[model samples]
Target chain A: SQQGEEDPQALSIQEGENATMNCSYKTSINNLQWYRQNSGRGLVHLILIRSNEREKHSGRLRVTLDTSKKSSSLLITASRAADTASYFCATERERGTSYGKLTFGQGTILTVHP
Target chain B: DVKVTQSSRYLVKRTGEKVFLECVQDMDHENMFWYRQDPGLGLRLIYFSYDVKMKEKGDIPEGYSVSREKKERFSLILESASTNQTSMYLCASSPHTGGKNIQYFGAGTRLSVL
Candidate 1:
């Protein structure tokens, strides 16, 4: 079973716009990571935020985690056509024996029009 | 740079046949995982290995089994391939660093069961 669920199953935007996607998980996690997948390819690790941290940034990607609310959000500022892809949030559980194993969310499909 | 490679980019097999998906990583990571991605179901973990010759079952591991004979190689096996088993299989490796659990994925293998 998946631990997280992303909102806005699909999003469409124009170039130079901002794209934001949200993910919510049910269990406590040691860290939450975001991934990007191009069409017909594997997933690329974007960023990882630990439970002790709240927000992280990498290039144009900004991720905020709210442990109290058990949710996280990914923000892509000044999005481009190349940024169009599927975004997924994976949670690393805190209590399980599979410490490093990840449970991914349903993902959000973002399409950026040029 | 870390590189995870899959044995096949696309494969077609008849139903009831045995299937094998191979993954190799060059980063000497301690963790390797197998996941299957579908249209609406997102990515679900099939199995994971923390070390050589050690395996653990994931949420959906009924018909799937994993083999990790070496540190850098992990393989997922399907006992009886079915039409419903047709999906994109992704392999990932992650380093067991301190509080960092980011996974690097291979370019997925698209399997079609006829």
Candidate 2:
């Protein structure tokens, strides 16, 4: 319902398991980015996928964007305890008077059990 | 590597007091942003500056102001800190180049307004 809304507010999984989260936005966007935030720390940039692109891979992270559906998904493969953190999806709206504005979604909190 | 730094890790203030949160980046980024993070609310942009001495309000700019007098530093000011203002404040910077312009964030400042 929000501009950028992520599903599965919290996730708990065993180490080595894959974690997947979904994000949906309302309006058209130029690109979508994923960020990870450890507890009590700043957010770390993960990956970015442009609207025209459907999938992107970075290290153990894989992100997918579906512009026609206005949705995106982030998949963390072989999760570790160190990967336990909150993940957020941000949307960079298409160019206009308010271009370059990055709006974040309510993040998905991932907990990796050691 | 791009690095963004906040002046404080934790700050305690009383209601109605003026508070200043400082952020500096070593990356010489062209755009800087200040955001407040709250549980379930995600990161709400307070203000952003594209260039020195130029600022634009973000989605939630009320009760907060920003200053960008230099290329690497941006400051967020709360004229009258309120209990509702007790949240994690984050600062980020990005080069406004033609690329993805992924943002680098500082370790947030946690402000508790009593």
Q: Quick one: best TM-score, which candidate?
A: 1
Compose the digit string of candidate 1's lDDT tens values, residues A3-110. Answer: 999998999999999999999999998899999999999999999999999999999999999999999999999999999899999998887565488899999999
Estimated TM-score per prediction? 0.97, 0.97
Worst 10 residues of 1 chain B by lDDT: B94-103
User: For residues A20-77, could you state the per-residue lDDT of candidate 2 as single tens digits?
Assistant: 9999999998889999999999999899998889999999999999898999999999
Interface RMSD of each: 1.0, 1.9
Candidate that scores best on lDDT: 1
- Candidate 1 Cα outliers beyond 4 Å, as residue runs: none
Off by over 4 Å in 2: A97-99
lDDT (Cα atoms) of all candidates against the true structure = 0.94, 0.92
* Pairs clashing within candidate 1: none
TM-score of chain B of each: 0.98, 0.97
Model 1: what is its DockQ?
0.82
State model 1's lDDT: 0.94
TM-score of chain A of each: 0.97, 0.95
Candidate 1: CAPRI quality band: high
